[model samples]
Target: MDWMPAEKAIEDVRVIAAPEPRASADLEAQLARALSLRWEEVVLSIGRTQMLSTSRTGLSLAQRDRLVRDVSVAILTQIDIFLERKSDRFTFQTLLEELADEERTSVASKVGAAIADVEMEKSGFRFRANARELTFEQFEATQSKNIPDFVYDSGRGDETTPSDVVAVEAKGSLSRLRATKSRLKNLAKKAYEAQVQAFVGSTANDSIAVTGGCAIAFGATPGNGDCTLRLYVSAPAGGTDSGGAGAAVRGPGLGGARIPRSLSSAANAMQQLDKKHEIERESATLDPQANGNGPGHHRPGRKRRRGPNAHGRIAFANYETVFRLCGAANAALMLRQCLDGAVEREDNPVMQAFYQSSSDDRFLFGGTPFAKCWSPSGYFAIYKPAAEAILEALAANRSTPPDSVTLPELPKDLSWEHGAFAAQADGLTWMSMVRGDFTTKIWNLSSGKW
Candidate 1:
């Protein structure tokens, strides 16, 4: 190992981030239909990316089907909320404060992500690639424990060079008002994770040499039982947190791809996490006692099978895992059922073609056996390549590439302006028409090889 001078042991990564995007005011039916289609498109695309005929990609056909079912249902549930409540975001935000820890974390995740995209664009950055898909070796350099949610280029450069870029992460909480403000203060620590990702991306792109900034947005309470959102950009260079003067974070620290970061940066980040955890525990409901139970503690029903997580390393269910547990026939049937449940018309060719994909589960799913684990390799395959591929295909068909068209790309995509698919009962309304549906029939994956 090469020795580094003592004075320069730590590398510092920092960024400027902020934003808020307004939700679109589309009618309930239009929103339901758009979100439903998006939910389907995203799920199918992810499964396709994860497997794509395993002989070609080597993923379990059954696992792909299972993932499509599990992940699609989870995404649909969130989209359904908008349909039922219309645009009353506050209702959802306050109710969020009352959810169980698992559910709250889930909701906060989606909300934080939406906020991060807006914050980055509002500060002038165009989407590049998702940092979550980058390998951990990249993150190791920054010495951060978390991953940045997304990466973006400023798009201000000429054809000869790429724009300045930044890694951005979203931090959020729906805890009670007091806790919300406290949580936001410490959210700064999470930004360095983004900085690390941006740093790595820059290394891959030949050190185009652009500055980076962190984006943090969290629920804030200025009134009783009321929740307003906020975005924060850390005070420049002086990363002097409330209690510590770890070091002054400055400059891009460009061209030092091999440099080691100071231990203080990692320490401060963890310290901030511990402090935030303590704040969340301010109420009795947040954490029950017993540190003595220790790190590997397990409580009854404590572990949950969250469908898929970008950060998960623990092996959960993947398509191949599910296919092996449930024989090909049953697995295929499960896929058929879920796909049928989501169908609105008998003539919707795209929906029809997916379920009628293939007879052989190996071929039916896709063949990337090694990539079948529901980890960063498969579950996390949801972003980057798949979205880019679809958008690229879409761009080729249109005169103006989507990357150039500056509209509210998000909720707008889920609105009437985006057009709709024909269905007797639009969206999940059709999903409900079939009572005792196949979606509720959980194919237990626990009875198989772990």
Candidate 2:
């Protein structure tokens, strides 16, 4: 017969770990006495049962049986309690219901209310707000991971520059209260990972804070357990448990982009949406400083002329000046409020159309792409000559004598097909045939050849 070593039996096997195991003072006293005795004597008494072994270290048969029974009961009781606590979370079906309702009310309501409030303003601002509800319904539409009770967004106005947004979550108890508290403490570690996977795909914006602080208000219901509500707020810059330091936000870092195995594809789609806007904001910031050659039209602090002919000239230049059209320094400042007093619309289909089509070509006419671009050649094509051509056409339409006009030409060696594809790691490829030319490329290039 196979046998386990006595030492192995004692390995990491503590009898006092459970509360009940240590509950009986009488049993503890007996255990202490047993431990205090010499090992050989105790072993002889329990194992080889001779007169010498029994004389000073023996127990009567009834006493031995009673001790074993009590200890076993304590151990089993403790195990049962642990198991019960572990299985205490809400049912998946119930959780889903709560999450769906919360999203419809809490997050979705906030977005709709904000959009409506902006539209009712009487100012001379021009703002278009796209209030989207990233509900369990939408998540289900993507057929990705179970919907998280959080959301993200981007906003802009004629008076202010575009920026990102993050919202709260109401995930019904994934872990128990004690367990969740512990997990929350360690959530800062996810900040870096969240930044990359959440924001990098959405044109490299902030990891759109999908889940954050929640303000839960408990109701007066009897059988609902202890329904204590809480308002969990996000730390200003301290980040979540799994988040890294602020360094992750400096630029696109490798650590930020690592996708954990636990992530679902649905979350990935949401992230891409965020990236599209980030690219737009970055591209908008690239507009040139001035529009004329007059010496009086120089940038804010640069050397320029104030015509001695009694013409007082003041010029605003660069992104700092242009960005003020949206708002102050706060990126999340509502777009409508920034637009002084103009037309405002919620779910502005016109603006949405612009966003949908222009996001990928943000640098069009600018001389370069944003630093975060994944495609170098494509960036050059749109931001350089393509932009110049469009600007020339606009100039020709607006004025009889165009200031300076130049037409864009396709590179002689590069065909339409060459401009439309991308290759990634693994053999996963993406192709676009929208415009006559068929372009295809792999999605990821790190794994191997495509």
Task: Estimate TM-scores for all models.
Answer: 0.38, 0.18
lDDT of each: 0.30, 0.22
What overall lDDT, based on C-alpha atoms, would model 2 receive against the true structure?
A: 0.22
How much does each candidate deviate from the true structure in C-alpha RMSD?
Answer: 22.3, 31.4
Encode model 2's per-residue lDDT on 117-221: one tens digit a residue. 121111111111111222222233442222222222212211222222322222212223312333322332232223212321121112122322211111111
Cα error, candidate 1, residue 228 (Å): 4.0
Q: Work out candidate 1's RMSD over C-alphas.
A: 22.3
Q: Tell me the tens digit of each residue's lDDT in model 1 across 1-450.
A: 011110111111232222111111111101000011122232322232222122122345556556544543453354334221332222242444455777766655554454444434333343333443233444455543455554455443332333444455566555564335445545655454344324432332223332453555545331233333333332323222323433232223311111144656644654775576355334213112111112211123333111111111000112222232223343333322222233223232121111111211111111232233322121111111122222222222122111111111121122211122111100100110111212112222112110
Cα lDDT, model 1, residue 166: 49
The Cα error of candidate 2 at residue 116, in Å, is 20
